[model samples]
Target: MKNKFIKISVCTLALSLLLGSCTDDILDEQSRTVYTPDYFKTEAGVIGGLTGMYAHLRYMYGQAYYYNATLTGTDEATWGQSADGNFKDADLSGVGNLNSSSSRSDVLWNTAFSNINAANGIIENASAVGISEALVSEARFFRAFDYFLLVQTFGGVPLDLGSGELKFNVSQNRTSVRNTVPEVYTKVIFPDLVTAVANLPDAGRVTGGATKTVARLHLAKAYLTYGWWLENPNNIPTYPETPRTDPDGHNAQWYFQKAYDIAIEGIDNPGPFALQPTFYDVNVATNDRNNEILLMADHTESSEIFNGGSLTFGSGGAPDNFAGWMLTWNYTSLVSGTTPAWTAKVSSVQREAAQPYGRPWVRMAPPQGVFNNTFADKVNDSRYDGTFTTVYRGNWDKTTLIGTNPVLYGANGIAVEPGDAIFSFLNEEPSQPIDFSNTTYNSGIGAGVLPGRADFVLPPSRISRRVYPGLWKLGPYRTDNAGGLGQPNAGSTRPFNVAKFSELYLVAAEAAVKGAATQPGKSARDLVNVLRARAGKWRYSNADNAVFIQDNSAAAVAATPAVIDINYILAERSREYFGEGYRWFDLVRTQKWNELAGTYTICGPNLTDVTPQTFTRTIQPFHYLRPIPQGQLDAMDMPDADIEAYQNPGYE
Candidate 1:
């Protein structure tokens, strides 16, 4: 609960700051005055230093780079536009574009090290300055968290545990060697997290800070990830110990048990962690900072400096626009209904007012197949409807047009209102023919068609390109500046939750199924059923009941309890965590990347003979770990041959 201030240089290895009070009055102004080691001995100074260490996290989680690395190349979503060479190459073609030189890859590497160095500064100096052991624990948690992500993304990263080595090696010689994945986990991540659990308080964890429970949750996750790695050691060819080919000696079950124990500790630990009653509570802006959120990439909505910029903190702070771009549609480019054509159209106030809709960026989209294939109970599952907005209302003033057109039905048979549903059934096949003769249906334009429109109606094919059921989970939902500056210029920002309590249940269920944990009377099926039951209840709730009108009620309910497996947990994760990030990592950690992503399709049954399935893509085994950034390899002070040796296998 300390609100200490620190002025940090994001690019550097040191976190230098003049300690400031927790109150905003003291932190409102910026100062460059530096404090001595004696200053850090005080509680405020240590907290201020901890603040600097936490600030670097925005670089990793609060941007498109991380999402691109994690979300693309997976089964859930695909690149929407063909022009983005990065997405096309890394995600679709599964080719060589994602090598070390990639700007995104380079930033991830730099950011991870920069934070790790800052954490090291705090940890090493904490003792010299006579700071609390709690500060050391917090610093270690961050060090472990950064190293965890680095190892997962790019295999072994350079391991530096102190400012002196980081500054001497990283800043000067670039001499730090890339540690192997297993070594980094065992040597750095695990120990730091264990210490973090020991020193931190039981609760009151914030977005940027960790609590004992938070540390435990991550420790569990770390165990789970490492367990998977042990089970599939070929993925970590650089692991120091003898690989587990026989799946016996300290196999995945061993770590899975550890993960299960820690996760159960967090569950039984008295804390504000629990699943939200309704699926909607987890995402809506009104519910920001709710108990369900374990950690979030916190953003400032009021301050323009926090306005989204592409990894450049100078534009303001590191407020990310992940929500503005991902899972959103460019409403401004919608095809005009009057033209009956698939051309770009501007947005209106009516369209702009919608809280969950945004101007089209069209960076990522899921194929109709994602819904049809993943959600076995698509209709009854509240997560499907809760996450996606299947309707877009027309902004054009069509009062006169509606008065003249008797067949244009609104809800029942009422006149078309400004915000009435203008688009629906977006999950339907693109080539499916529209029945304009059905006067009751408002398929944009049905019978009594307005002038200047064709009699036979065709659903806007460009919706797939521009507005395919915009994701509702990621939103500040702007009413202004629909498409002014694009990617990072989100006119308004929304807080992005990175981890939720819902995942703990899935983790427990997975560990249970893997025979790593005991549930006594309950099975893995029972744990999953708890989530399914919540989703099903939401489906039948008064507000959402009508949304499932198209579903076969009995069939949808029947699908929930019949079966539960790893695939079911994965599919449920896809439904629950769409575009919130972590899909690619989820697949890779579970060793399902190649199998699931190699055979992904976007259009599915919607593909007509002429359509050619535009979004089919595949993944290769080498994609299990991202290629070590070529920039890092080049920047290494070592011989060219040595750097090449350090590059991840198959990338060179």
Candidate 2:
């Protein structure tokens, strides 16, 4: 009921469930004394049960927002924002460290278990009292949901399959670890989700909240990813030099097929939500609200779009920072080039420095390479207009939009100087390369810019900044200029930003192509085309295109063809979901990583201290799974990976 942003008015009337609030100052075990079997005997108890789960969500939910964006353990693509930037160029020697406390995995692990406990209480009592089988489905679905997050981030965690049946000494007892990857999947996730799919009403069954179908999405993902099961060598048995033909372990392809089936089933059912009809239908400013794929999390309230408005992933810029940090220079270019091209204010120096703090989604610039390659404009891609743009920040009416004060001031904020060209990103073939005075890069030929040569750009034409074809679409609200929405430091005026949908479409498309289903029973090829066609980048006609073409996994494995490898899926996802915050994860899954620190030094003299491969390795570490939170390692008695090393010792 701590409604800092907007409180749900109907929620108060919907329930008389005011069991009690914890007397403790914060979430601690000592304060949680009111709980008892008799406590959840009424409908109010059900409401209380649900809110108890909701209370623990902010940590994991917020973490997901930011972590999803800067997935780079360390990559050049890292805009050096939030925990992402810190992990990219790992530093423990430094005074203040960023990656440790802010990580969602830590929060996710703890909160998931906490919610699981509440769910345990509900499952034990909900059935006997019999509050609509629907409500029971909700509890089970949510329980599955929490575990699903744990399964992905930490692998097979301590599964508390048993509920509040334990009391007395049980209150002080910690949960016991259980079931291997296969066991958890077969027992907990699989069965619960299957029940949810059947008895839980359709998508919109409980409008304004999660329904049965949403629960199925989690099932689909669990089946698709197959969680820690992928780790079992017995399942994915080690193969010979060439194993594609020999065959061995669990077919990852099968799980993906199941994922596609679940997704399609939900799509067919038209739950409480529907994908935005057009790119224009999406409101980037809000960051993420009312999204079709958004199973949980509320953006209507405060600080949802904490990162870079709509340019970066989940968490943009909420925490404060000092000057001289690289933000969405490339992102500005991409968003500017977008169809309704947003133009940002131009300034030589940031009047305000962006510090990496707050949530994961920060509106930092994309790496230089991304600007040039993947997300850039290619013959007027429909997504180009919606996704990419040049202007990194804008000035707009915030009072009317979200009833908030404006963030930027012309006399105070961005003081544009003479010859400072502000770029607007419109999705047309770029006529000429545009440059910013502050652009920095590593030289191919020789040492270009250096400390010795302070004067980098010889002429105004040779600006430090160069225009790449892509746009930073995540942060629709944030900018150094803070011109949009009127406040001097305001992030965005829009309320909802959709980062998951576009990217998920790509995920679904790729899985569908692996002999899954293009149109239910037909080839999965058309599935690819449907998505590509929507993006305005369908190269082939229906079945003729690379996406629509038949994909023989055997043929794919034989030639290491682009058509069937992880690269195609990754790249396509990058194209579809750029700025949505999955970049780092996508890279890790593919094992293509690099830290940003020294990837772009002025060409000419190579610094012995830093190398391109250093960045590469840093990024690779992220693939090992994000560095495990030190606090978690310290808190747990379990044997852990090298915690001091800032490595993600990996999930159990």
TM-score of each: 0.80, 0.62
Q: Per the 3 Å backbone cut-off, how many clashing residue pairs does candidate 1 have?
A: 7
Per-residue lDDT for 1-652 in model 2, tens only? 2322221100111001111233211111223334455656666666566655443443344343344334433322443323343433332113123354545445455556555655666666786777777766676777777766655554445454232221111233322333344555665677778877777775433222446556666676676656224423222221111122212245666676777777677656655556664443353343245555444333331343222123323223322111112233322211111111212322222222121111222323344445444544444344544454332232222223322323321211232221122222333323453232233332211112323221111111111222222232333234432432223233332332222334345555555654465564323344444455555522222111123222223332232233544455665666665544455444433334332222432111122212222122322232234334555445433334323322333222
Against the reference, the lDDT scores of all candidates come to 0.57, 0.40
Q: Which is the leading candidate under TM-score?
A: 1
Worst 10 residues of 2 by lDDT: 7-16
User: What shift in Å separates residue 195 of candidate 2 from its native position after superposition?
Assistant: 1.9
Residue lDDT tens for model 1, 466-561? 336677667554323353322234433555676777777778777776677575634667666666766764523222224333324344445655
Worst 10 residues of 1 by lDDT: 17-26
Model 2 clash tally, residue pairs: 106
Model 1 score (lDDT)? 0.57
| Top candidate, metric lDDT | 1
